[model samples]
Structures are given as structure tokens and as C-alpha cells.
Target: MTTFDDREKAFENMFAHDQEMQFRIQARRNRLLGEWAAAKMGLTPEETDAYAKAVVQADFEEAGDEDVIRKLMGDMTQAGIDIDEAGVRAALDEQQVIARRMFIEAQ
Candidate 1:
């Protein structure tokens, strides 16, 4: 006894729930990245705060996820931080896996 309207409503509810889950997962990833970056920088408390802000700002301003990771890797290298491409790629891959999981869950 399902009508067209009922089906549409169900789809809309599912879509909204998926979107929420994706956002939550992304937020978690960002927080983790900020902590990792701060530790890598070996910053003092004050410097860590500034570094975390810069990380989040860069995340916002980057063109996309890949671009954000590339920028971070490049900056780290330029800073003489001794980070390799493999490490950067691995971090990005981990985050991508989380994102993909969220996408699948949404579906």
C-alpha cells in the first residue's frame, strides 16, 4: 500500500541521513589530521594552536581533497620536515577509505 509520495519521502529521508553521516566522518578526519600535523610540527602549545588553525584554513582554501593533501606534502617538504610521498599518500588513502565507507553507508 505504498504511494509515490511515500516512496519519495523515504528516499529523501535516506539521503538526508547519508549526508549527515558523511559530514560527521569528514569532521572526524579533519580533527585527526590537525592533531597529526601538530605533532609532526613539534610545536609548542601556542604554535600548535596556530598550526592547527593553518591546517584547517588550508583545508578550506584548497581546491579539493587531493589538492589539499598535495599542498600539505609540499609544505612539509619545503619546511625540511623529511616527509616522504609515501607517508603523505598513505594518510590520504586512509582518509579516502573512511570517506568511502561513509558513502557506502549512506547508500
Candidate 2:
């Protein structure tokens, strides 16, 4: 049987691990978004790197995932890309699926 202190330590470790995993997932998503935005912008190799970093920065600085999605959708619309909310949601969901698969594979 575990003591209260032991249980508390276990919970703390679990929380830390979970937080680390979430951070890694967010970083991966940011990198992927950066790459996609760079390609869409037709940036040169050097420019692509810079553009990608900007995209990731924009994503992190947003209020939340929804805000980031809205910004992306609005930008695409302004560029005549013809995407809607449902489309953006679907894309984000698909990306999440891909990220999960990649995480599993890495393990």
C-alpha cells in the first residue's frame, strides 16, 4: 500500500510527464504549420525557414487554437483559397490524427 506522500509524488510525476508530452505535440504542430505556410507563400529555402518560424510564432502568440485557426482561415480566404470553418476544423482534426500516429510510431 502506498502512503499519501507516495501518491502525491506519483501524481506530480504524471502531471509533469503529461505537460511535457503536450509541449512536444504543440511544437510539432507549430513546425508543421510553419512548413505548410512557407510552401503556400512560395518562399525560397532561406525565406521558407524564416516564414515557418513566423508562422509558429504567430500560432503561439494567439489566444488559443481556435484563434490560430481563425487567423489561418482568414488569411487563406484573403488569398482566395476558399476555405471555411468546417474545412479548417477538418484539417486540424486530420493533423491531430497524423500527429497521434507519428507519436505512436516514435514510441
Candidate 3:
């Protein structure tokens, strides 16, 4: 193949890898966020695990983070937690950093 074709393939591969990593990081962040919320709600260990998985699944309902945020906000509110959207959003941001670091260390 020509040099241009090789470069194009390299870029495509990089894009795919980046997309996959972003998905992974976001999933991890969601799990962490769920665990955080679960603790706040005083869930049992088993319940926390299930709730974390549910939070990860919540991401699939929409294109952005709003779905997961809404699920968390609703669940927390129902459980009588006094947290607000800003707090959840802040936790989401913090968990994202931790998730990214975890992935990098795993590599």
C-alpha cells in the first residue's frame, strides 16, 4: 500500500482504540458513581454490586451522561438522600479521573 493509505489505516485504528477506551472509562466511572450512591443509600454489599451494574446499564438509554445522572438523581431522591445534581455531577467528574488512572495503570 501507498504511504497515504498506511497513514489512513493508522488513523482509523487510533480512532477505534480511542473510542473503545472512552467507553471503558465511562463504564468504570458509572460503576464507581453507583457504588458511591449505593453507600450513601445504605445498600447491602450484594445490592451495591447490582446497583453498580444497573448504573452502567443506564448509560445505554441515551447518547450522553444525562440518563445515568437522571437515574442516580431519582434513585437517591427516592432513598431520601439529600444530594443534588451538582453533587452527582462532581462525583461523576471525580470518578472519571480515577477510572482513567485505573485504566492507565492496568495497561
What stretches of model 1 exceed 4 Å from their correct place? 62-64, 94-107
* Residue range with the least summed lDDT across 10 consecutive positions in model 2: 34-43
Error of 2 at 84 (Å): 1.4
Among these predictions, the greatest TM-score belongs to 3
Query: What is the TM-score ranking, best to worst?
Result: 3, 2, 1
Q: Which runs in model 3 stand beyond 4 Å of their true positions?
A: none
CA lDDT of each prediction against the hidden true structure:
0.68, 0.69, 0.97
Q: Can you list the residue pairs that collide in candidate 2?
A: none
Of models 1 and 2, which has the larger lDDT? 2
TM-score of each: 0.67, 0.74, 0.97
Pick by lDDT: 1 or 3, better one: 3
Instruction: Give the Cα-based TM-score of candidate 1 against the true structure.
Output: 0.67
Candidate 3, position 93, lDDT? 96
lDDT of 1 by residue, 1-98 (tens): 56988999999999999888766666556545655666776768787676656655666664556655766687677767888778876776686577
| Best lDDT among the predictions, by candidate number | 3
- Give the C-alpha lDDT of model 3: 0.97
